[model samples]
Target: MNSGISGYVIQRLLGTIPILIGVGIVTFVLVRVLPGDPAVFYVTGPVVTQEAVQAVREALGLDQPLYLQLFHYFGQILTGDLGRSLTTGQAVTVSLMQRLPASLELSIVAMTLAIALSIPLGIIAATRLGTWSDYAIRFAATVGVSLPASVLGILLILVFYYYVGFAPDPIGRLDPFVATPQSITGFLLIDSLLAGNLEAFRSAAAQVALPALTVALVVMGPILRITRSSMVDVLTSDYIRTCRAAGFNWWTTYVRYGLRNALLPVLTTVGLIIAYLIGANVVVEKLFAWPGVGAYSIDALLASDYAPVQGYMLLMTALFVVINTMVDVLSALVDPRVRAQ
Candidate 1:
């Protein structure tokens, strides 16, 4: 069993190498093909001289042959250098390091919120299939799926911040008056608590709640639907019927047997949800004025700064690969059939 698991994990890791290389190659080619010249965008004045634009292009290595540029980029990537941002003049890695934690924190919180609410509701709806409870849950799930994150975010701000006056200002990560905690971890919520700054923690949590909720609402529908369908299938399986006939109680029969069997599909949905959350963050982050990589990438994209956009795409691709590997391993552990395969 141990050897099989090891083989599976090793195989997954090895397979990801080519994927990363492919993503890097595609990102390099696609960014170069985008309209507008980076040098022209970077150099701006009332009357910009051709010499200035040419100099900027050379400095950024944009004047190099495409093949040479690709080789240089791959070399830099191998050396753990993501290159400098043409707009900000900071290392792309540095910016990612600073901003990724924010995006991750938001994603984590939203996923937690979604899973916490979705699974139980799904179970209830499954157990009560054909009843009013199931219909209500299904209706709500449909609405959640249909609602756009941007619209939901604006409505949340209006209802909670403007009308209700419960939510904090829909601004950055924390209130202006709150002193940011010392950065032990880049996550504000964790770093605040680590530094024993409850005030900052509360402020950060409040600021994150609305946008996180917005993201959760957008993702919750798919998770709930998957869980409900999986559970319904498991509960109706022959083994479950056997358990029901063998005098096994409801808890042991459903909670233990049904939920365990239902988990694999739900787990897969969760992995896909993480990717969706990353895309949703691009909109939610901008709406909330959150300083995360999604917002950072948007700024770079508007300026046609190729390095940062490439860095963002490569970073996100690598992240998805890691998530997929973990999901595969977890599915294997959950079901012996997957491990045997």
Candidate 2:
């Protein structure tokens, strides 16, 4: 069984090769096709000599054929080089690394909170289908799904910061007044605790809470709805009915016979939500002034910073591929038919 699982993982990973290549091709071409040149965007002022622009273009390898440029890009990726930022002169890899931790930290907290809240709520709602309790949960999910993130963010801030006065200021990760933590890992929340600095950790957590909660609320909708649907479907299954008939409590029958089968769709939704949240939190990041890759991508897009934009896209593609592959493996482990396939 272990060997079969290993073979399944290997086979699934191998299948991602062509998919990633296709992603690379699309990302490379679409970014370059955007209107405006990097050289023009790099100029600080409206005024610039034609020769200076041409020089910038040449230096950026913008004059080369698109195919050749793409070929060189693929080669650079092979060598672990994402190229340099047109604006900051920092390596794209370096910039991404610096910002990724905050994004990861936020994404994880939001996903954890969302999944923790959503799954049980969904299960309870499913069990109580047609009651006011279920109606209330569905109504909340509808409101959550419909509310714009910006509006939710403002409401949260007003309630938590203005009225309650418990949440921290909605500035960045750490307040400028507080001393930043030493970075063994880039996550300040963890690093501060590890360095025996609870004060810093408290400050950081407070500041990030509202934004993370806002994102959590948004992500929870789909997860809740899907879990409810999957649960409802599984509750009506033959095995669950048999278990229920054998003098088992509803909870026991659901747990033993229903939930395992229901989890595939729930897991799929969770994986897709994680991938989407990785990039789709630009508004949340901007609202909180959090320096995350979503905000970085926005900056690069506005500036027409070609290398950074392409690098961001490629990284996102790689992330989605990795996430989906893991989800597939988990799905196979749960469903024997998938392993046979």
Candidate 3:
């Protein structure tokens, strides 16, 4: 079984290379094809000239043939060079490394909230299929699924900002008044805790909570619904009935027998949710002014910064692939039939 799993993992990792190349090609072409030139976007003042635009294009290697440009870009990436940002002229990899942790921390918190809330709610809903609790859970999940993220974000902002007055300003990851902690992981919350700065940690948490919650609320609904449905099916299986008939208590039958089987499907959905959350962070990040890769991608798009945009797309694609592969492996482990096949 270990060998089989290892082989499977190796195969998936090998497959990712071609997938990443395809993603790079598609993203490169799409960004290039988009209306407006990056050079012109950067040059806005009276000092802008045709020569300046050409110089910008040359600096970006936009003057090369399409295929040659892609080859050069790929070569640079292979050597651990992500190139300079068009807007800042700083190294793209460095910029991403600096900003990625804040987004990752937020995503972790949001996904943790989503899984913690969804699984139990789903299980309860499924267990009490015809009860008021079930109905209430269903209604809540429906509302979560139906509401747009933008509206949800606005509502959260209003309630927290106006009603509570404890909300932090929607600008970057930390307040300007507070000094940022030393960059260990680049995650303010973790760094603050590590550095023993309680105030910094509190500030980080306050700033992150709204955006994270906004993302969680939007993502939690589908996970809840899917988990409920899967749990319901598992509960109806013969093993569960047999367990009940064998005089096992309701809790044991439901939790041990039913939940283990139910979790296979839920795990699959959760993996997808994680992937979607990574991509969907764009709007939440923007609304809250969180410095994440999603926001970086948006800024790159607005400025037509192809390198950063391409890098972002490639990173997201890689993440999705890795997550999906993990889900597949986990599912195989949970379901013996997959390994048997």
Candidate 4:
């Protein structure tokens, strides 16, 4: 078992090196290839001088040879310096640190809601099969899968803002007047709670909930469908039948034995869903004007800010890789045949 785990860990880690390099190379090329020059954007004048643009480029180290620039960027990345944003003139790392907390909080809440809603509904639907509850759940999942997040965000805003009047203003994470919690890991919700500032915590949570729900609605469908299918398959397995024949109750057999085996495939789907949710949140964030990393990345792209864009891309790629690696490890652990030589 130890050898198998060790082998899997080493192989996965080694495999990730190439994947990271490929992602980095692709991001680097794609950002540079995109239209609009950061240097040009940085200079402000009716009569833009070549010297001004050159100076801006040189200051940003854009004047350096492409390979040398990439080398320097990678060297800084190793030292945890992601460089500065051309648009904001702030450190890319600092910007990410400031904004990532909101994104993380939102993602976590959305994921929690999705998991909470998906699993039981999926199990119930699968168990009931042709019943009305099953049909209703299936219909809900279909609607969720079909709706775009932007549309959902808009609908949520309209309902909450116009009809209900319960949601906070559709603006950034919090009102500018409300001072954010001091950066302890940058997650405002957590930092505020840790500091025992109930007001800040409440404010953060209130502002984040709607956007998080929008993201959750966008993510819940796939998780529901995958879990339902897996549950059905596992419930009908020979071992499950044996357990049932041995006088085990339906819920016990389903939850204890069937669910455990069913989770392998569901885990894979969940990982992919997580990756998709993170990517899809960009649209949601923009619609809600939430000051998350996705919103920051979009602004960076619009301004041709390469460093932040690169950092954002790398961060996203790293997250997806990590999630995928975890899913693979869990799946292998669940299915012993996967670890067989």
Candidate 5:
């Protein structure tokens, strides 16, 4: 059984190679087809010399043939080089790494909040069935799923920041007044705590609260629905009936047997939601002026900077693949029948 699971993991990982390569190719092609000259975007002036533009293009390797450029790009990718940003002249990897922690911090917190809330609420909704609690949960889930993330973010900012005057400025990760802690992990909240600065931690938390809540509320609906459905099914399963028939109480029967079985689908849903939040939080990031890869990609796309845009796509694609693969492995681990199959 262990050997089978090992083989499954190996097979799944090997399968991602082609997917990454395909994504890289498509990203490269699409970014190049974007309508703008990176050199023009880079050179700042009311009037620019043709020689200067030509020099910028040459320096950026834009003068190369399409096939040669693609070949060189693939070679650089193999060597772990994402190339320099055409606009910023910084290494694409460096720029991405700098911002990725912010995205990771937000997504992780949001996902954690969603899962933490969704599971118990789902269990309640399932157990209650036709009660007011169930109806309320369903209604809230429906509303959550129906709302657009951008609109939700705006509402939160307005209500909390503008009207209530409680939310920290929907700005970056930390307040300007707060002293930034030593960058151990690049996560302001964690770094501040590591530095024993409770004030900085509070400021960081306040800054992330609205954006994180926005992401969590938007993502919680699917997880809640999946959890409720899975739990409802598990509650009616034969083993659960057997546990009840064998004199197990309602709580024990549901908690021990039902929830364990129900968690597989919930886990899958949570994993997919995590991937979505991590990759697709551009609107929230932009709205909050959060320094994340999503906002970075938007800037790069607007400037028609091919390298950064391509790099973002490839990085997100690889992240999606990694996350899905981990989910698959975890699902197999949770349900031995999956690995057995």
Candidate 6:
């Protein structure tokens, strides 16, 4: 994938359009089919009259024909105007933006932790080959992959927060008593640092530790497996063998040749992991009470709040397209086989 990033990215972007549109259409249709209409839900309980229901439906524009509603929804998408939340009356755009930063911050930390730990473990497993250490690493990865994310999060909370009393409460992003740092990038850590508030940064970082560790454990398994497999294959390749035969410096040979060549598949896995973190961290988010987009989407989905769910899905789809395109470009740059194609 180490060829030309720009050209590959452009090609991928072009290919991604149809896929995004298809996803948007599917989400729009699927959300509408789910039980519990916003209008119906809001108009429930005693004295539930047809007029009241009709008024609520009219207010939410649910009375419009399906085609006309979809056409308008697509227009909103084109104009970057996600509709207002039917339940909360807040603009979907505003809510998503406000909550998005927290999700991004959590995901970035989780993946960073995963990559840091998983890569070395993977490298060790590959280098150790048939040793007991390698078998132990494989076993750990299998267990990690097997545990559901929520259970992993609960375990972390029990061990660190409840038993050890080291981790912060799983109430939300910050402790109940800690004053919030001034918002800069909306990332609490970076913003606190920028504001020269070490205390704030530390407070925010502590709150995320348990949840981030949970996500890291879940993500590390696949990444570890892939990295080890890639490194194993690369180490056995002719160039690597030549380098070893030539008696090149050990670390240099490993980093410059072995690691670089193995990054293509790793990069692909990383991109998918990041996207998964973005959209599929709902269970973890719930366990930790993290104020993330996934939690917001879950709340909306429960009430059949169409706009937020649709907007959330659309945003995730666009994100996958953009992030994966970048990954494809990187892969093309790293592997000449990809570049040649």
Which one wins by lDDT: 1 or 4? 1
Candidate 4 whole-model C-alpha lDDT, 0 to 1: 0.84
Q: What's model 3's lDDT at 338?
A: 76
Clash pairs, model 4 backbone: none
Q: Rank the candidates by TM-score, best first.
A: 1, 5, 6, 3, 2, 4
Candidates' TM-scores? 0.95, 0.91, 0.93, 0.90, 0.95, 0.94
TM-score: model 3 vs. ground truth: 0.93
Say which prediction, candidate 2 or candidate 4, comes out ahead on lDDT.
2
How would you encode candidate 6's per-residue C-alpha lDDT over 1-341 as one tens digit per residue?
A: 23356666677788878987898789988998887667878886789888999999988778999888999899998988999997788999999999999999999999999999999898889988999999999999999999999788888888998999988888888877877888879999998889888887888999888888999999999999999999999899999889988999877777788889899899999999898789988998889899999999999999899999988987888788888877777677688898878
- Which regions of candidate 2 fall more than 4 Å away from where they truly are? 44-47, 238-251
Q: Show model 6 residue runs off by greater than 4 Å.
A: 1-4, 44-46
lDDT winner, 1 or 5:
1
| Segments of candidate 1 deviating more than 4 angstroms | 242-250
Q: Candidate 3, residues 22-46: lDDT per residue as tens digits?
A: 9989997899999998878776678
Error of 2 at 241 (Å): 4.3
For residue 34, what is the lDDT in candidate 5? Answer: 70
- Candidate 2, residues 1-341, lDDT tens digits: the string is 47877777688678777876787788788888889877986655667988888888898898899999989998998898998887788999999999989888899899999999998899888888999999999999999999999999999989999999988888889978888989979998999998998889989888888999999998899999998999999888888778867889866877656778888989999999898888888999999999999999899888888778878877787787778878878888898877778
The TM-score obtained by model 6 is 0.94
> Each candidate: how many clashes?
0, 0, 0, 0, 0, 9
- Consecutive 10-residue window with the lowest summed lDDT within model 3: 37-46
lDDT sort, best first? 1, 5, 6, 2, 3, 4
**How much lDDT does each candidate structure score?**
0.90, 0.87, 0.87, 0.84, 0.89, 0.88
- The alpha-carbon lDDT assigned to residue 211 of candidate 1 equals 91
Model 2 TM-score, 2 decimals: 0.91
